[model samples]
Target: MFNRRNFCQASVLACGAFAVASSHLANAAAVMAKVGQPLTEVAHLDWLCNAVGLTSTGRLFVGLPRWPGFENTPSIAEVLPNGTLKPFPGGDWNEWEPGKPNAKALVKINTIHIFDDDTLWAIDQGEDAGPHGINPGQKILQFDTRNGKLLRSITLAPAVLPAGANLNDLRLDSGHAYLTDSGLGAIIVVNLATGVSVRRLADHPSTKMSPERRPIGEEGRPLQMPDGSDHQVHSDPIEISPDGKWLYYQPLSGPLWRVPTEALRDTQMSEKALGDTVEFVYDTGPLTGTAIDSAGNLYLAEYDRPRITVLSPDGSLRVVAEDPKLWNPDAMIISNTRELYIPVPQSARMAANRGPGGVDGLVRPFKIYKLQLPALYGNRETVPALVGKPLA
Candidate 1:
């Protein structure tokens, strides 16, 4: 014979108590969770590999930049199932040497990507010759991953790619390709069909490195160049949204910024107008690379720390994984199987980071790591299926 009001109050109180308990449990689980525990060493190589690319069909490729020290290594190779690397596309493609005919060979491959159509794309930054300037060798080459046959090559013209232009990263859509010129701080857009290229947002504030921001290395110190200047990289990491509507990018020292893809592709848009369209995304502190899931969540490689953080669509941020071995994780990739491939290039140990040493402090036998993402994060079904659809 309890009163109806009393019973309703009691039920509400019980529900509230249960909710509070559930929340406490969830928080405890998150605190005890070791997201980095699942991270495993997938491939180990003697040379420095900066970028990892996975094809839709599961073929894996790694880009080895012919940096100042490692000049003779293959610019591109396919990681075999046995964890060995085979020079990709065979023959003399990987046999590039100084003063040789490099027009047809791989010069300095800074980044590589494989589309769902089984096309392997590589960006030759032409820095192998010692970052003198952009040359005829600075080109984008596409190959059929299945057959290892060169399909098309598009060279960056001097008009668009000036001297000291370092083409860092690229993202492709059905109609155009977007690239970051880190050296000069600009975004380059290339028409996929016509091979026509245009430089946009040249030295814009968003693309330029923030003078107030400096990168901290795994050693817990500020990274400096040989001349004692702060290690500066402008417009380095680039990513296209899952819907292909927005292009997100930032410098090595960053607060992430983005702009509409429509503005970037608009040939008639004035620089002032285009620059106005850029929107501030988040204050991402020191990032190397980024990948976006189908749900528009961004997985960013935290450069200052050995960790990866995911930014949800709702603007909440959380650490997805952290490992002490992730030293200078460069360009990252998300495979079709929902695994995030991370290449620890140890760039922090490079010559630039070792002040006045002029000697590369890179630890040999660099390792590439892979982490199986939890189901709470996006799975294979949530991965952006940009394969058949036009990215735009």
Candidate 2:
């Protein structure tokens, strides 16, 4: 006796209930953890907070990407330990207008990296992909973290950023920066001194997302793109060995790979040669972010399994911690290798999970958690002397 309308309503309600049950299961798994403990929620936000950075002096910076359900607000802000948000550097940089030179301003901050030298580097993802005539909206900015003043800004060349380039996270080594382009499946390397950035390993199997792995979420549900396509999280997490000899990188769903930084720095290196140099590491199911300690240990976040894994220099892998609270763990940073900070955005509840006209599924108050560990070395301040190293 039920009509089509009633059937559809029932289906939606059933799916919602299923999602809730999955969340409960995840929480239950958290209780089974025997290694690292559940995340200590630092600050809560009503909006999507995808990126986080911590300064040695204890300043916390958060980036809010302009995604669906994002109330028109500043894209980047500094969160005091007391949990107050202040527009970073300046609010004007976040205010964008159609005809204005918005590229110079902080349009949309995809990631932020706080260095030991008190410099804050940010990747500003300009407009979404479209036939807008290739605007110079994509760039990188460095600021003096101590005073929240701008230091330098570099607008990337059009060739470096093709249509649909999501320049995700970055790692700094010596005087160079390496960035991952998730949207186009590529890597971008920038010279900190010369401000010249080059794109590398475009469409390489190592940089491309896995066709076999789908970022599953609540109730074993696969995350979906806005167009109802399966969400393919591409090359995102990146790290540099403490010695700065090798650059470790992988797609969100990984079979981790690395190549010598010596080869990576060579502007003349052919794409085929670079591909030939890539060494396959372990197969990590899916990891969104990674950081390396001074001893060359790599910490990777497996958001789907809701745990963090550590890969040693000798190729040994172990689970550092597992907890249900690690939902959609995105950007991660290690503070002096003593603490690992992870932000859980619960993206399975975001709009893209449900496609167009999708209702908001996530609860309010997003989370940032940290893990304490034995004192270790971090590479932010230890720029290895790889400037003139032999590539051979």
Candidate 3:
């Protein structure tokens, strides 16, 4: 006869097995209450959460990079209202094993954005730097937000992404997409229709990180690499204007720059001509992610001071929100509800592959927060104007 002790032990084992088998939907249901005012804690993740995006309907999507420990975790997930993370566009697209066939896998999602057309777009960084060298898996993906249906998957040309390239943030405008490669210090422009892409501003002053720049830690100290040198991230922030005419961007440490959309699409234009189109906007001291409003105002996630700054269309900078709880705000999205959603990953504190220090380890249960915007802010409830000619 089975004793009570044995029964309890077996029951516990059964529950453990169930949880492991259903890891795909783990921690997505538990609700963690708000931590602070204005900055309400949204979904909490034990893994390294990088960026968050919201659809026009207010659906939440979050991305997890394949860092050291979370190699096989879902690269992209939909955070339900109940706070559970379900693989977006579902199925085995997010599942991958080393030796198995991962042809359709979302290996590592560096950043994701929901566009005006109700489509979700992402930059899959592909491979991380293993002990050997840079792993290679970069690709661009597009999906329908309504049903998680994948619309497009375009593998980037090797010429666009060199050996050290780390595909970072992306912004969609008109019919084209602009992507920043932080590791290689360049900007890539892609024609969505034909999937043709070209690398731009490679080694251009605008794309390179400020030589003396270093991200500050939560304790108000300069972040340093293991070697004691200043830590840095290259061209990581890119945002398109509400009119789709201008593209503003800069490195992690920056003096911001802007260029006309026409200049990026003109493949035949000489390098000097393209460079001439770029204008020195302003010096954004220390920033991570950015978003733009229809009124042409740019919202910046200013990391050092830990606040959101609005760069007005007339070239004035003003603080939008300043809260002590805002630590290392990464990717930001302006929702149709006139709210800016910021995901505070505290990425710099987390430990990288080597050990603690840069990317060492921060407080767990990473959070996403939203700050309301004024009613006059241009909200993209419907699809924005798709300007410029479609690809041939």
Candidate 4:
């Protein structure tokens, strides 16, 4: 039932997506091309959306979303090169620190990278603080990747967090960093050394609105089903280029945007200056997620589509892979060889088997799959083919 060809066909539907299909994969191939079979389906998370990252120490880490849907699910996973999925050591899904506020769930993991020796920063969207739908939510927790030790928990400064701000994905600079407040629709800046942070572009037009916000028909018109229902999607997966020259991001719906890293980090610059540098990179009707290659290319997973397209460093678009199996291709990691590893989400399928929160009412068995085809997977140095073991 889950094969590469199903992925290919699924991509066609997503790209041509007017609506998410309710039909089984076996009956869908005639409409789209299928790629190779899913290398494996990872069922460790409660629900998997944007939980993806390839760390420097030859490991791949995945963040899991736990909650009403993902009850008793894993909070983090390390995909070992041997293709096994193992629990992240920091916080056991069942254990919360003594006298601490109740840990609700895992929303999304921004990205995993070695911030310093033996230390890795795991940005968790604690829980969408603004609206009930904000999601996987805003806690920025740090850990020692070496042995899964809890190092620190970074909180939003009162100065930076207006009440009801939900932090999204995060990107790190040498000594500074940036995070997106999808709940509040703001860009948060943090000084790593002092942990002093500030929020900017709270409602910047670049980050919030998009013509791509709505799904488009294959003919480029707003696509909808015969029933006259609409598919509404927003927020997203984002990444800063390797050299930190450009920040490329897109909300779920479309119209990917970017601004020069210099402009974004130039805290001293006027708002007009920062806004001046923010540019509309390109528009896709609806995209599932995006990843940046070391060479400065961005690979976007078209939400309902099969192909993973690239926004070249030079501001051009190219199709990196047109495989059929990339259905619901969501977050991705680019290894050193430029091979892209995407976690094609099967939430729709799992949702079918389990109910809303999934089987057992816990959204059990959420799957994040990996694919290796033409492109860098991310500065590859024998990182696990998939991160299944704890960081050594």
> Whose TM-score is greatest here?
1
Provide the overall lDDT of each model, using Cα atoms, as 2-decimal numbers: 0.75, 0.70, 0.69, 0.53
Alpha-carbon lDDT of model 2: 0.70
Q: How do the residues 180-213 of candidate 4 rate in per-residue lDDT, one tens digit apiece?
A: 6655466777877777787766656755634434
The TM-score of predicted model 1 comes to 0.86
Q: What residue pairs clash in candidate 1, if any at all?
A: none
Model 3, 1-392: lDDT tens digits are 10111101111111111211111112122232222125656778866677887765677899887765678678888898888888887787888666555457787788888766667788887766532345465688887777777777777766888777788888876567788888868889988777789998785777888776655544455556556666667788988876677778888767678877788788997767787677777766668888887787778786665556677766555556656556678888878777788888776565552233545557777888887775545664233423222111
**TM-score for candidate 2:** 0.84
What is the TM-score of candidate 3? 0.82
lDDT of 2 at 172: 79
- List, residue by residue over 1-392, the lDDT tens digit for candidate 2: 10111111111011111211234235434443444544566788766787787766777888887766674657788897678888788766877654567755776678887766657788887766543344357778877766667877777767987766777878878788888888767888889888888898885888888777766665555678778777776788888877778887788767677877888889887888888888776666567777777788777776566667676665555565667677677777777546778887777778767655556778678888887743333443354333243111
**TM-scores of the candidates in the order shown:** 0.86, 0.84, 0.82, 0.70
Model 3 scores a C-alpha lDDT of 0.69
Model 4 lDDT on a 0 to 1 scale? 0.53
Tens digits of per-residue lDDT, candidate 1, 54-130, equal: 87766689999987678888989999999889999878889988877777899889998876566778999764434
Residue 350, candidate 4: how far off, in angstroms?
Answer: 7.0
Worst 10 residues of 3 by lDDT: 6-15
User: Which segments of candidate 1 are over 4 A away from where they belong?
Assistant: 1-37, 127-132, 358-360, 379-392
Kindly report the root-mean-square deviation of model 2 from the true structure over all alpha carbons: 10.5
